[model samples]
Structures are given as C-alpha cells and as structure tokens.
Target: MLTVQEIRELIKVVDESAIDEFTYETSGETVTMKKSGSKAVAAVPDNGAHTDHPVDPVKNSQPNIQVEQTEVSSSDEKPIVETTADFDHEIVSPMVGTFYASPNPESDSYVTVGSKVEKDTVVCIVEAMKLFNEIEAETTGEITEILVEDGELVEYGQPLFRVKKK
Candidate 1:
C-alpha cells in the first residue's frame, strides 16, 4: 500500500508532466488520477478493483486528492492580441515543447523586444522529447513583442513572437 505522502508526490509529478492520466495498481489497491482542466482528481478505489464505472471515492471513505494547476489566470480572460495593429507578422511555435530564449542559461537571449532579425536567423530554441530545435526568423522583421517567456511550455502553432515586417 502506498502512503499518503508517496501518493501526493506522485500526483505532483503527474501534474507537472504533460500526461493527463495516471494509474497504478499493486496487491489489491488501485490508484487512478486524472487531470481536469485546472484541477486534478485522484482516487483510490475502496474495493481495490478496476471498474469501467466511475465512483465517488469520498462517499466510500477512500482517499481523494485534488491538485490545482500551477498557472492561474484572471476571471476576465483576455486574448493575447487585442488587435492586428500591434504587429505585422507572428512567429509561431512549430512544435509542442519548452521555449528557450537563449542557447543556454549563461548566454544572452537570442532576441528581445524591438530586436531586428532577418530570414534564417536563429531566434530561439524549443526543446521537445529531449531534442533542442533551433527556431528561425523565417521572415525579416523587428520583434515587436515576445508572446512567451523563457522555459514556458508552448503548443504547436502558438505565437512566440510578434514582428513588424521590415
């Protein structure tokens, strides 16, 4: 049987990872965790049996763990770009990964707000599945705004930088 602390640690790891669900079974105990938007629902079946039907662990005196997402947003959620007048071109992420502003921790950032860049210039790096991919400035422009921060997770097609075309 897993202790409460051990299970909580596992939940933390799962919440941090990109995985949406995790299940572990040993002996007769079964623990299953699922991520629902900003909250995590963790349950341990009272009977220690896997079933297709969902049950309320709280009603059965089973352990229930709820973890909140680390990132928080305002109740009035606003779009990143309110208007097209702010920029002429957008440098979108090519893959889902962690964004890096510089080549390494000790190096200066590849580009900053108002920095000029030309086609084929390496602007940043995206790390996915242990591979660091160099993202280029496919269009010539001056960076008007950076849409994402260093080490933030970005999705495919998500805008990373807004550029004013030269």
Candidate 2:
C-alpha cells in the first residue's frame, strides 16, 4: 500500500514527467492514469476477480473522470499480507492532499514509533486547498508505522498509518 502523500507525489511525478499514461499493478491492485482528457483509470479486484473501473473525480485532483469495474467471486477468505507481523489494520486517507502528523512545523508529532490510537482520535492533519483537515484514526490499535513524512502531498484512499490491533 502507498501513502496518500506518496500517491500525490506520484501524480506530480506523472504530470511533471510528461507522460501520457501511467499504469502500475501489484498483487491485487491496478492503477492507471492518462494525461489526455481529465481523469485516470483503474482496474482493481473487487470481490475476487479483476475489474476495470474509473477513478473517482472527487478523490483525484481531476474531475469528471469515470472508470468501470467487474466483480468476481473470491475463494480465499484472507489475503496474505506481507510485512512486519505486528500490524493488522491500515489507516487510509479520505482525500487527496498533504499529510502532516503534527499541528505545525514547530510542533511535535501526534504519534511516534509506537503510538496507540483509537477511533476518532486525531492522528494528524491533511491539508487540501489551503484548508486544514483533521485526520482521525478510524481503528483502535498501536501505531506500527508511519508511511509518509510531514508536509508530503497525498492522494485519496492512500495508506498513511499501519496499526497493530491492541
């Protein structure tokens, strides 16, 4: 999984790189963006099979983009996760913007290497369009890792924090 900031940076990279279309695929996820008209396209495995879908305009900086998806049946119950065994939950970004784990540049971060959090806990702030949006932990767990640094640009649905269920 990638942090929202990482995704934003990727978009920036794509735009700056002067590429028309970018496609990336991992285990069960596929992301593609075209710089011609407006939005990017995505192919993701919804139930179990690969599906073609358009990226949401509200989530991406570009609007009026649409993709389609095809749902398939999945036989497996749990996916084989690869990482340190301490974490079980992932905290994801709800919008495309910048990520800051603290209030400001001069303030200490909300959590560090092993911070514990709960649902509704203010974990950090994501700035979008000059507006500071408070990002809260939607799951209760111990902080296993922080995916991005402060002041980094992020994208919608990106992973920001990995948590270990307490």
Best by lDDT: 1
Please report, in order, the local distance difference test score of every candidate based on alpha carbons. Answer: 0.63, 0.58
lDDT, model 1, position 97: 51
Error of 2 at 155 (Å): 1.1
lDDT of 1 by residue, 98-122 (tens): 6788877778899999899998777
Q: Evaluate model 2: give its TM-score.
A: 0.52
Give the Cα error of residue 93 in candidate 2, in Å: 0.9
Q: Could you tell me which 10 consecutive residues in candidate 1 have the lowest summed lDDT?
A: 53-62
